[model samples]
Target: MKLVRKTIFWLHLGIGLLAGVLVLMMSVTGVLMAFERQIVEKADGFHITATGNPLGPEAHLDGLRTAKQPPSSLGFERDATRPVVYQFGKEKAVFSDPYTGKSLGNGNTAVRGFFKFILSWHRWLGREGASQATGKAIIGIGNLMFLFLLVTGVFLWFPKRWTRSGVKAITLLQKRLKGRARDWNWHNVFGFWAAIPLLVIVISGTVISQPWATTLVFHLAGETPPVQGERKKPAPFTLPESLAGLDAAFATVKSSNPDWQSIQLQLPFAKTATFIVADSHRGRPDLRRTITVDLATSGIVKSEGFDDLGPGRQTRTWIRWLHTGEAGGLPGQTIAGLAATASAVLVWTGFALSFRRFFKKRRAAA
Candidate 1:
């Protein structure tokens, strides 16, 4: 038992040191993005009137046509009073009047751009083109190591004998802890509290980062997994010739989900329009629904919600929402943010302790 603990201790310490920097980058960025949804929502002003006739996407786009670049997509906010927002790409966005379809200039561009920048670093280390793939690969490997550290860390945290002092050290904050002792206590305390949420965040991120993790989700659920990266991404900014489908698509989706809190149309220059509605922004997966409307015939095509997904696919979907803490809503995001903050501190203390051990050993030998 002692031998096993020693082996795990060394492994945990070694892996944590190697992956500590990558973990720090992800954790700090995660903390920054935790309240992103709510902040962006408030910044853009999404207020849906309980009673009012809101204009369609075409009405909103009417004013934006004279812009330097045509909007790639147009979406309806939760309420009629709010302006409809359109995006040029991931970063640039413009809001238009719901009544006149004229451009209301732009909505929260800095905040949106800031979040996008943080997200790029978090997922791909802000690398672009072919190098982004390299960034993703490194991050994925680092994530795996972090997961290992988390598992072994819990084992190492448990004491051989649970005395009152030992329990307090693990579960309580010791006073006036200095230098190496301070680092040790901080590492254990932050790790002990953040362990659960960090596990969820890392595990879900693992599922996202690795294709095998995704396949495993399906295999465990006894369902056939879809082929990875099979779908060819269509040109993002392709503007449709006709804005006629937007109204029909929005109306059909609204009828399907009368109690829907928000809806956004993924503008595709196609015979059908896809509308995604949610009970809250970036949260509540169960209350979320995707409805497709046939633009040509102005008929309801198909409506699918969380309940409609198969168990395997549902679990797969849950992995994504869980990673972003969207499945559990605001409380989930808050926990994730706090855990991420704890992770940054963990890395700091871990490095501090490691440096102390090495220097202390050298000094003693000398």
Candidate 2:
């Protein structure tokens, strides 16, 4: 039993040494992005010139005629004070006055850009293009290693006898300790408290990162995963020259969900039909619905609420919310953010302890 425990400790130490930097980077970035949408909205300054009965998508599309790529989505919140958002290809977007079609430009483009930049590093290791695949692979390994560290750290931190002194060291943090002892205590304390949420964040992330993990999630839930690219996509919808169809379609969808906080029309650059997602709260799966509208008929083609999802897809959707801690609202985000912060501390202290032991061994030999 002693030998097994010793082996687990060495494995944990070695993996930490190998992947500590990656974990540290992810942890720090995660904390930074915990309140991203709210920060961006605050930065946007909530400019409202006028609202209610705003112009249609075609007018916005015409306004953006010079854009290199057509926007994929556009929408307004129920709040007249908020600017309309036009999401272009990839990370590009423009916020504009809903009443005048005037460009708001996100109030602070730099702040928006900053979060976009951080998000790139957090998800893709700051790698782009074909190299993003390589970065993701490396990040996946780091995630696995980080997850293992949390598990093993627990075993090593558990006091064999559960004495009062052991409980004090593990639970009650000491501020005066120095050197390796201090680092050891910090690492254990942070790791112990942060384990469950870190596990949640990491495991949800792993399911997101790996296709097999995604499939396994479905399998574990006793459902077969949907085949990729198997569903036949509807033919693209061409917009009418009048563009009146779009306004009518949006109105038809809006009339049904009068209390929607925001309703975003997703074009997907399709020819005749588009999807509008109406939600009372951002990231709240329960309060959301997707409506497919036909541009030609100005009719609802289909509507799907959260309850309409299959068990497999529903669980999959929640994975994203859980990973971001939006599932439990603000309190969940607080816990997840704090856990990520602690994870950062754990990595730093673990590395410090490892290096102290390494140098101490070399000095003794000399």
Candidate 3:
């Protein structure tokens, strides 16, 4: 048992030292992202109250055009407790309101700004070339290292356990210890408690960051590349056939899903394209609603219930939802926020421990 602890101890210490900066970067950035909604609200002068009624995407676009500034692209998005917001580029274009048009005043986050800075530092170290790639690879590799840290931390915590006394010892914070043991104990206790959620966070995070890993996930979940369109310079807006008579399509979908909080209309970008509408109530996965209308006939071409998503698409949705804690509604989002906050604490403690050890070694050598 001592032999196992000694070997795993060195392994954990070494990797923790190697990946410390990356973990700290990720943790600090994650903490910032946790309060993203709040930051946006404060920075942009946006109100997050319920709209009670939202206009169709086309209507909103027309409204923007009336204002003499149509967005290059319009997106409908949700943040914690807010109705779907119309976004143009990086900020909220407007909240969903019935009568008057009011801009949300650019919903940028102070927290997110700091978060982005940390993320850049973490991902690129603000450098270039193969060095940038090295940063990403190191982060990816650090995720794996974290998993090891969690496991070994658990074993070390339970040197010969399965008792109330041992468990209590694990739970207690060791603030008084002065050297390697202090770092070792802190790593063991916090790492054990934080194992499951941090693992989920990191794994889901890695899947998002690594494109090839994401593609592999798609392949595993049975997703093939969607059929591609031949390259063609598309015509300027010619009263899109698909959207020409969306009144009936909108009525049909609304009639079917009366509980929807908001329905977003996505106009087709080019010839042979299809217009799309997706609805959700509180952004629940099960409530995912979509319909595609054929441009030629102005008839519904395809519709998808949330259940209809293939495993690959489902996997994609799950990872995104999981990361943001949108999978579980308000509860999930709250949990994710808490996790991010806790991760920041973990990073701080981890850094203190590692640095303390480094100083001790220096002192001993001197």
Candidate 4:
């Protein structure tokens, strides 16, 4: 029993130490992303969203082909409330906007910087030349280490037996007396309560990094695979195009959802571009729902809500939401953020304890 206890403790402490630096970086950066939307809204004075009006995915593609600025790839999207949004990426340029085809400007905006930095740190540790797979592997390994730490930590905190005295010893907060026990109590108590959230976050993080996990989820949940089509050269939309006329497109879609208070239009990158719009409900900034429209045909193509996502997608989505606390909205995010912040403290204090132990062992040897 003593040997098992010591083994778990040593393993927990060693793993924590090994992954401490990376975990701290991920936690700090994760905290930044938790309030990113609110922060950008206050700083930029604008919230880029989409319209729920249905759009022709093919027409959007056609418009792009004619524009001469056709993207290498495109993705349809919508915010909490808005019209359809199109994302075009290439070797040199990446454009994001509504299907009505408004160019919001380049990708170098200040608000985008926050997202870029947080993502880079979380995924790559900001290390240049590191492949995404490598970054995810490192993060995945770290998560597994944390899971192990959680298990061992629970064992360490468990009392030797179920007697009343042992139970009191296990449950009592004697940290008030100070010294090693105090730090140990804080680490164990906080760890015990925070275990579920921490484990969830790490598990979600692993999914992000592991393709096998994603594939397994798709098979298990029986989700439809993501739509993927070929990309061709750009062909700009013809004049009289008015880039598909923003006002008419907006009015047509807005009539469908009167509950929406604001709408943002994005221009197509090419003639094939679709009219994308987005809307929000209750004034919150999450645009998990949206509608799309085809510029040429002006027909509905896709309508969906994040809440309505399929099981396969939701598994990962919910995990990400749990990680960022966005799944439950503001309250969920706040709770998760606090947990991450606590984890940072744990890492710091854990290191201090390990250091103290190391020095004590050396002193004893002398």
Give the 10-residue window scoring lowest on summed lDDT in candidate 1: 45-54
Residues 1-366 of candidate 1 have per-residue lDDT tens digits of: 989999999999899889999999999999999989789868876444334466776666555555556666676766657777786656577776666555576767777888988999998999987798888999899899999989999989997788998878877778888988888988899989999999999999999998899999999999999877654645545455567766776777777777877777775557888778886655567778887789877788788888988888989888898887877778888888899999999999999999988888899899
**Cα RMSD to the true fold for all candidates:** 2.9, 3.0, 5.0, 6.7
In the range 1-366, model 3's lDDT, one tens digit per residue, is: 688779997887787777766677666666656545555556665455554554445564555544434443444443333433554444324454432334544345555566566656656664566687777776778776766766666666664757876665566667787655665565556666666667677778778767776888888887883443454733334333233345455555556665655555543344223323345533366666666654446566677776888888777777877776766666666666666665555666666777776786799899
Q: lDDT of each structure?
A: 0.81, 0.82, 0.60, 0.61
Instruction: Supply the global lDDT for candidate 1.
Output: 0.81
Residue-wise lDDT of candidate 4 within 66-158, one digit each (tens)?
465544434333344222333444223343345445544444466677687677778876654637557767877877777677667767877
**Residue 359 error for model 1, in Å?**
0.3
Model 2: per-residue Cα lDDT over 97-148, one tens digit each: 7788888764688998898888889889999888987888888888889889
Write down the worst ten-residue block by lDDT for model 4: 269-278
Candidate closer to the true structure by lDDT (higher is better), 1 or 3: 1
What are the clashing pairs of model 3? none
Candidate 2 Cα deviation (angstroms), residue 324: 1.9
Model 3 segments beyond 4 Å from truth?
47-58, 64-86, 89-97, 102-105, 108-135, 174-186, 219-244, 269-283, 294-299, 354-366
